[model samples]
Target: MTWGDGDGFVTCELGHKHWGRYGAAGLLPYHDGYVLLQHRAKVTIGGGTWGAFGGARRRGEDPVAAALRETAEESTLDASEVTLRGLMHEDHGGWSYDTVIATAPALLEVRPASWESKGAAWVPVDEVAEHNLFEPFAKAWPRLRQALRRPVLVVDGANVMGSRADGWWRDRAGASARLRDQLGAVDRYTGIAPFDVAIPEKVLVVEGKARNIGPGDTDVRVVSAEADGDDKIVETAASIVAEGPDVLCLVVTADRELRRRCVAVGAEVTGPRWLLNQIAPKAVDTPG
Candidate 1:
């Protein structure tokens, strides 16, 4: 086995020995009510037990990047095929472990590509507890199960544009396009109250004059409304919630009526100011 800088056991402040000197991370890829897990080889730690495909992180590597690299080394699956959802961190005083959550479009075939794994399988979520699980993974499974779903941020373009006093009344389409572009450039977010992290599936709903705005060169999905913007927003939230139980929809709008309407369809409501604060450098003092 090739040894890396982080590949040794170290006792943490909690007085527990961990495998990595820097830290460790694991990948949890879910799809269609199932999760991909690895069966550890007899010679490895937690041998013969099921756990995430992972290992010690390389020095100074980002947790997400480490998780992806470890998973790719241990299995046939590649990181590019999956969409990163969010992250769950477990701090052991001086040491830490990050569980990187992701979603696959389909149940892609994966097999053990390294000696560390005895096998790999896509196990149904309901049946996970039935397996002989690794100790730490077993303890974290319940919380991780509850957090499997990804957050989808639905932005009400007209409502949010109105909130900003940046002279958006002149050209609504230009304002909408600007919003879309800003949402794309965000690498991370702060003050996302509902979730621990904010890597989300962004949807911007534009209406009336703003409906003609082109889809910008970002990952944000722009939904144009034919008539009433509020109606379209409600419809969009309902359709997304219906997609699966794992989806967590958070609508960004200050419209009281619209907030109540979105809540009726099972979406959590936040304000436009929170969205603006995340994408822009300057803080918004206006009320959402």
Candidate 2:
């Protein structure tokens, strides 16, 4: 109920002690082939070992905000320097430590700015294990490394809108906006993907009348295609995959030709059914 009320130690079901009364979180800032790591102060738990920038969450703080706040306090970087991709959780019975794996638009200079952090550096993914690592982090590194790339889901606004029998054709922009709002819930929906994922990046490509659906604060990003929606979707996916980072680009649509083009450029294709099905309970017209 007060600031830092989540601070302090508690043992997990496995009889191992962990910091934070509430679950803790860490910010994993990644760019290119490197990820930021912080060397812990010798006086702290798992001292002198390297891990992500993070610590105790304050009372009522969400994991992502906590991670970012901790990262800012422990390092010279600010929240503006990174874009959050998704959250990954390491559960220990009732306790858990969530990792906020984010994508940095570009690598920024970093330095240890707090006593809790002894040093900071951007370590190449392959060299992470060579450093003295926090025990828990060492164990989680391999699996986490396998998922370092961000996933982007490019939705065909028209295609998904058409799939529904709602009176969408009469109001394409409203339908597109409705679809965009519904997509914000996708991050909380699970079990559809084959593997665990951080929240994937979502891009909604709208054309024709729906093209009027401009950008706003919705979880879904609207890209008004200057021409064909399919071409724009494919181009967007191709540009993302071409970045050369470990990334998954999924163009959401049932159009066979669009699917072929997207997949041809190292992207994946999924029908609108998967997304619509997952967010069904929220109702397409309902705000996310």
Candidate 3:
């Protein structure tokens, strides 16, 4: 229907049907390197256990929106104060729930504001393993750790092509194909580039004719759509920042407006050269 319209539920016949009937969202709030977790009330399922703040998604709400809403309802923290990281997992089967991970700039003073939680507080990065944690969260924790450190890279293919001085307009398909092949090769050959810290996610957005260029077998995820790639990139970045606390999003483009929009939402911006530099190979030996 529309944004906020109630979509029907989806069910699976898997064993141990749990957390079904309603979709769910969660806030993996963070500050610095630490994360905020909630302890469920003793009477609740998986109660007296530490987990991210989350609950059933409301009809008409996307997972990220539902997550922020749930976090506010379950804890005293305001939803607007947090940044989304991205979708960590979509646990489907007998019960389906999307885990929306996010981060905050500060260690919020969290307390149970509703019946779902008994206590809420920040857990140090090193101490996450000490607590009795929910099973799904525990199983996903290692992957999540890696994901949180990865940064989403949003590229403006059109802008980047223009920068190449290759007359892409005369051969849009060829230019796009060359770019995609280069990117794929970069993914295959580049050693994990050192980041100040590890990055857990890398995404590339392509639009127009370039949209047809897929990510191929690369490790990076690609979003190719007819829509404004800049807008799509912004939305993706915003979603990730909202759901995962440890992740960062860096949009690559020269578009002033798009850059501004992303920065306003707590995402970082880089120029097209950053991506081009990655694919540029170093000088090779020409020995006889």
Q: Which candidate should be chosen as best, given lDDT against the real structure?
A: 1
Best by TM-score: 1
TM-score of each: 0.91, 0.86, 0.54
* Model 2: residue 112 alpha-carbon error in angstroms: 1.7
TM-score of 3: 0.54
Better of 1 and 3 by lDDT: 1
Indicate the residue-level lDDT of 114 in model 3.
78
RMSD of each: 2.5, 3.3, 13.4
Order by lDDT, highest first: 1, 2, 3
Weakest lDDT window of 10 consecutive positions for candidate 2: 188-197
* Steric clashes per prediction: 0, 1, 25
Question: lDDT of candidate 3?
Answer: 0.66
Ranking by TM-score: 1, 2, 3
Model 3 is weakest, by summed lDDT over 10 consecutive residues, at: 188-197
Model 1 agreement with the true structure over 164-258: per-residue lDDT tens digits: 88778988888789899999888555445333565788999999998877676888899999989899999999999998898989999999999
Model 3 bad stretches (over 4 Å): 1-12, 150-159, 163-288
Per-residue CA lDDT of candidate 2, range 1-288, in tens? 123788888899888898888879898988999999999999889999999999888777899889988888888987897987766778897578888788888778899988889999899999999999998889888867866777778888999888887788788889888888888655743432422545787888999988877766676778889887888988888998997757877788999998999999999888887778775654544532
What's the lDDT for all of these models?
Answer: 0.87, 0.82, 0.66
Of the pair 1 and 2, which is ahead by TM-score? 1
